[model samples]
Target: MIAALRIPLMSLLAAAVLAGCGPNFAERSKTAEELTDEVIYQDRRRPPSRLRDVLFSRTDPAKVGGVNKYLWNASLEVLNFLPVQSVDPFTGTIVTGYGTPPGTGRAYRATILISDPALDARSLNLALQTRSGPVSVGTQRAVEDAIMTRARQLRDRDSRF
Candidate 1:
């Protein structure tokens, strides 16, 4: 019947969508570690992050968790796929901001002072630059809070523990 056909069609669509979805957090974390190690650690020509030159080069990044991770990840989320040209670990400055333009309804900027290089890039400044939905302020805050909460959990679980 039509109902039977509809159900299968919907299920097939769902499966396709799910299959196309990317890796989750754990996978991303592993990939990031590998990439960082190869690019920043092994490649001596590249400037070293605190993590890269220190004893914890591999194990040390583990000491930071929660908002830090969220903060770092958020930078990557905002930056998305921009290539890097220059960097200074002492300060947080990405120089370039990527993603949708601000007028479209979503944007923000956060200038974070970074003391560690193991985090994402050293952007002495990060401006989210997105269009704000009708309720964007609260929603963004909520999202930031969730990131902080997750960060707190990460810090507690990984570093503090």
Candidate 2:
């Protein structure tokens, strides 16, 4: 009689332990798609949790955030006359303060954005402004052309290496 009771008690204990394992009712009730969406939402909301994530996050192995090295160098070299306010190579932005060109009387400021890794005309954007207002489209085009020409020259020079 004691052996029979022991088996029943052991089975009851095993059932109680197994009941505590696995997902709770709320989690188990969600559909697979909902669960997946919830996971993605949580991941997006979460900030970098590790040092490696902070150091190399949003970086592509094939490029440096789509910035063209030739264009970047050429922009600085061509606009060296203007005082640099800020530069971010990762974002491919150069902001310059107002300064007269070598042969010009009027002061001008320039902001350059290199949006692509290609050394092409479309990859360079130049916003030129003077003390009164933005410069003419012709002037803007001229500066862009100069920067593009210099960028091509730089690329050609680098190829010799």
Best by TM-score: 2
lDDT for each of the candidates? 0.47, 0.86
Q: What is the lDDT, from 0 to 100, of the residue 111 in candidate 2?
A: 95
List residue ranges in candidate 1 displaced over 4 A. 1-70, 73-88, 94-96, 100-127, 131-136
Model 2 lowest lDDT segment of ten: 57-66
Off by over 4 Å in 2: 1-65
lDDT of 1 by residue, 1-161 (tens): 99879999999999999977966655535567677768766854444557647654544353233223444545445444444444443244444433343455344333334345343333223333343423356644564554445544555666555
Q: How close is candidate 1 to the true structure, as a TM-score?
A: 0.30
